[model samples]
Target: MGNTMLYVITSLSVGGAQKALLNLASSDFSRDYPPVVIALVEVDGVQKQFAEAGIPVHVLGINRLTQLPWVLPRLFGLVRKIKPQVIHGWMHHGNLFATLTWWLAGCRPVLLWGMHHTPEKATLERKQHALVLKVGRWLSRFPQQIVYVSRRSMQRHAELGYAMQHAQVIANGIPLGNNREQAAHYASVRQELGIPANARLIGSLTRYVPEKDIPNLLNAIRLYQEGGEDAHFLLAGEGMNAHNPALQPLLSALPDAIKVHLLGVRTDAQRLIAALDIATLSSQREAFPLFLAEAMAAGVPCVATDVGDIAEFVADTGTIVPVADAAALANALSGLLNQAPKVRESLGEQARQRVAARYSLNAVIQAYQQMLGKVATYSVSNA
Candidate 1:
């Protein structure tokens, strides 16, 4: 018999939601509460992450989940066969599929839906959002509890009018590895990227998507340099090739003194974080990004846009600027950079302390376990 099973958005690549779910399903929490994972569609690489952690994964080869009304009965068949104690889903697509599958299976398997971002910030074309929003609100009724990566995310859902009394905010946790190779890793990366040894490094780790607003980051860096702040910018992540052709133009417009290293999608994000003098997040919207938490855990001070739960997360440890305002972002970066080294160092230290106290993987997983137990008990009692 399988354990509490989770159906996810995709298992192919790593995202914040994927990383958090994998951490939980493969965590030591399994020793106290058994678990299993089901990927809704064919996904690669993730099986390896799970297998390495001794967690089992099952993938349904559904080509397009957007046509879930047609695809759900088949998924319901799979759930009926597995008979897990609970069915948890991730992202909007995964939540819809899992909730429908649970209802169709004729079993209330302690449905839990994970919302990783504010819906208003989704990449979906605006024309399609109405249908997606309607479906999301309808399906939300079936879940015993809805899990959000940040309070801001939950609030967005409520603002969108998806009222559920069981809504909860459970931020994502990150397990930053030991800083064994911290200095060496940064030195090597910086050298390879051709960044100047003495130049101030201001960096960000984010996928090059429009919502991430890489253009604003480029403009912010320009402002930083224009104000006589000698700096280099490093953007580490892959670009959505077809959509993000703006990157090349931004790079071409820069002077040689301001280096912009595009370290395309890396598993070594922590190493990249360690390589920087300062880090940033200039997204138009977000839900407590992994980059911010990872940078904090790696003891890097950040200046980010006041989006999602960032203001709540940063508190006084880092600077918060308004979204998409390059001038404001540049000013904040300049101020943080110009501070005394000890002052910056102290801020970074406090940032690390905050992450350790509230955002450790072990602590977040324990919270999920308690929530899962409540979900299970409520489902059983109501059954």
Candidate 2:
């Protein structure tokens, strides 16, 4: 009920969940529940984004997960010093560290775990997720709660044998910026990129990873081109490398006429969305992507694979196709091109309205505020 300090996340890069954390940091809700963010890892470039909103941030400077043991004592010391009302975690590593640190700190700030996805399997860069899950189960004794960005993620966790009752769905929101400015920015960006004035651009804004199914979208584009459409496709995001075995061969194999452009990550996603005639998300697995919400906020008609809670958010507003189905995705994309301008505009309006009503920046922050209050109270009562 009083001002709440939130030790939010610890990540090396500023990704979707980090952006969501930024939105929360920038909210006027501080008038009701003041929030503080502490990144357990070095708080990458996101610190500036929060600082622009006059929010002070703390970084634990955890350089590597292997150094977690070295960081734990300091992390605990920092948490005790800060004594936030709620110790919240954003993604898996952050969640594990925050939950463990809070518990070790005698659960000073109520432990609130933020689950961004169905826990990802271990990769060469990170430890196994099963080990993380074991830690979560062992630490479930604390008054811990979860905030799932979508119901799909919540269901996935339950299917994996985690407690469903402790989790709540809090869909991430898009920042309500100046739509006109976004449009102008898009115009300049398109001009700079050398896109033809009349060209129809289909954009897929996602990290170039295996789960994202970037190849599926490329295949769909191939299908669209083979059927005689001259659409320009842009794939934008950071961390894309054609050298990685998972993605390298596919990039090499793309047809010359397909005209694929990889515009590595940009913070000005709204501008990119504004430039797009249509936005696409070809992920084979998603909980609820901020990209889809962002595209809709820019009033771009979306064609997304029905992977996460996308169907629920996009109901009747845009096109949805089965995951990895090139033909179905191609049909959906083509179906929009022949539609009247007024009709397409109406669809775009619907997409924007959906975001405004349900996924607005204010709405999501309010939900977190309320959830934080409840978790803090619950933690205190049980303690």
Candidate 3:
């Protein structure tokens, strides 16, 4: 098996899939076969991290589908130069793009695709996305292998007419350790926000997107507050800051006694996750909620609405509630708070241990490396 692999994805933005790619590419197991990131469009910041990992990154510099024709030449040239033994796509558009590259480059590398989304998105997906999803089903058999981060994603895609013969599930992983030092930083963060020492600091690390259901989280918080509890809520993600006009009214509606601190697009998620008394997620859709896994890794007790593979992973470590039910989410959060400090601390340690045992970064990278090795073998034999 040749130790060269190329990864294609729609964008290199700071999201779960992007972070998973970064973690896999930068890990020690991937040192020999570093990533050749082919982003469909130019996005900020992550390119630098890839470069620092000694991975080559290529951005097509195109925004709309109309611009794809202009970038085909450049894409073909990259494939020719790299001559990767296996070409893997990250998502729907990326899978299609890699398929196009396989045809245009005339370099028959073994092709693979990665699917990170679930069917929950299809309910409200735009026309363009619907078209891509349709195209993916029609062309799903081309990829030698298709990898999903969760069992639910794999099963749903199969029901949607995707080929399942060559598919497998490889869950996302995070760097694991007891983040005592990073967790301690939460105290200073709380102090800066003027939160009383005795107050529970509940934190959520998520992007403010429709699928994430920020409104659902706000409603849950409001319900909890009305139940005679005062807590500090810290939400860190893109469009979560005070500057977002859409989010301001929701923030204003929360009782002044219940503070919600919005820190937009922070790079220090580990520090924030470690310092929290509880971490929560209220997403309407998800595959494998990376934030909860990260929170568990950081030794924070979690209270998340059951979605994706969240219930499977969280298990007995944290509380799970019904999706979109603010009352249930609020009750779960309050239940965690009602526990003794030592009890919560014990649960946090158990959460950290669960993450370490199942979803370590090393295990995931090794799984990818092994899978690609098999693909390289197939490529060589088929050639």
Q: Rate the local accuracy (lDDT) of all candidates.
A: 0.78, 0.75, 0.85
Residue ranges of candidate 1 with Cα displaced over 4 Å? 41-47, 61-77, 104-107, 121-125, 196-199, 240-244
lDDT top scorer: 3
Give the alpha carbon lDDT tens digit for every residue of 274-353 in model 3. Answer: 66899999988889888899888888889998888899999998999988999999999999999999999899889988
How well does candidate 3 score on lDDT at residue 173?
A: 82
TM-score of each: 0.89, 0.90, 0.94
Flag regions of model 2 displaced more than 4 Å: 41-45, 61-65, 104-107, 120-127, 241-248, 376-383
Which of the two candidates, 1 or 3, achieves a greater lDDT against the reference? 3
Question: How much RMSD separates candidate 2 from the native structure?
Answer: 2.9
Worst 10 residues of 2 by lDDT: 118-127
TM-score of 3: 0.94
> Model 2, 1-383: lDDT tens per residue?
34565655765354777777777666776666566676776733556777777776777777776877777777667667666666677777778777776766663766778888755442222556677666765664453678889887777667666765677888886876477787686678679788887778889878877778878877898888888888888777765544446666777776788877677656767777788888888888788888888888878789889887899998898999998899999989999876887888899889888999999988887787777677767767977
- Flag regions of model 3 displaced more than 4 Å: 121-125, 178-180, 191-198, 377-383
lDDT score of model 2? 0.75
Candidates 2 and 3, the one with greater TM-score: 3
lDDT-based ranking, best first? 3, 1, 2
